[model samples]
Target: MSTDLPTRRAPNWLGAASAGLAVAAIVGEGFAIGIASDGGWGQATVLAWLVIVLTAAAFFGGLVATVVGLGRGAGMAAMVLGLVGNPLVLIWLLGALGTS
Candidate 1:
């Protein structure tokens, strides 16, 4: 008789990676904000695009982590910490761009 059963949660490393990606997304947003504020390369469309990409990745990644790795808590943290902060960052980014 087999005592070990398959686990429902993803591997520890994957959860950790998800968490890291979430954090990195926020860092990227900070860089984007800095640039948007004329603190760095102003009017850098490429960097703006990069930030948008990272934000999308974070949101999707966080969704996966939340669904498959929620047992580890990293997924939930990513959802709560990363997802919550992202919208405001995006709004601020847009405002800085004078889009809204």
Candidate 2:
């Protein structure tokens, strides 16, 4: 007699959420850049907070999905893209630009 194990897969919803949040992080970063370039501290502060939240969500969500092996590509992409939009990094770059 032959025995077989059932197939398992990570939740699709989690992967989708992670990918979506990652994209949002990128978009948020773009807005931050525009606002900072225009010297809009008021808007930039609010946007910084938003980007931080999005970055955190994207990174963690993608991590979970990647570990489970579902949507690995999307999860990895999210992690990379999320880091690219990190608010701390943005602050440093913006400061340097302002100084220069």
Candidate 3:
């Protein structure tokens, strides 16, 4: 038998994409809050919904990346951000709408 070595490639971009999406989601939520505070409930509602959807997508995408042996650090960061950010934004949105 010949002595040989297999080469390993760098991880794919899913983890980075997940991280980017999570950061975007957080910014979107902040924008939604600002809009709501400015008496723009309609716009805020739409933005909040969009943020929620993006957060979910990022969370799942990160999980998939991690399982696929990609950038687990970035993926985990995205997942944690989604887990913490989504609910807080949702609650704030709900409270704002309820009081309006």
| Highest-scoring model, TM-score | 3
For model 3 the TM-score comes to: 0.80
TM-scores for every candidate against the unseen true structure = 0.58, 0.72, 0.80
Give stretches of model 2 more than 4 Å off.
1-10, 90-100
Global lDDT of each candidate:
0.63, 0.82, 0.86
User: Which portions of model 3 miss their true places by more than 4 Å?
Assistant: 1-6, 88-100
* Residue 8 accuracy (lDDT) in model 3: 88
Q: lDDT ranking from best to worst?
A: 3, 2, 1
* Candidate closest to the true structure, highest lDDT: 3
| Stronger candidate by TM-score (2 vs 3) | 3
Tens digits of per-residue lDDT, candidate 3, 7-60, equal 788676998899899999999999998999999999999998898888998999
Q: Report the error of model 2 at residue 17, Å.
A: 1.7
lDDT of 1 at 39: 53
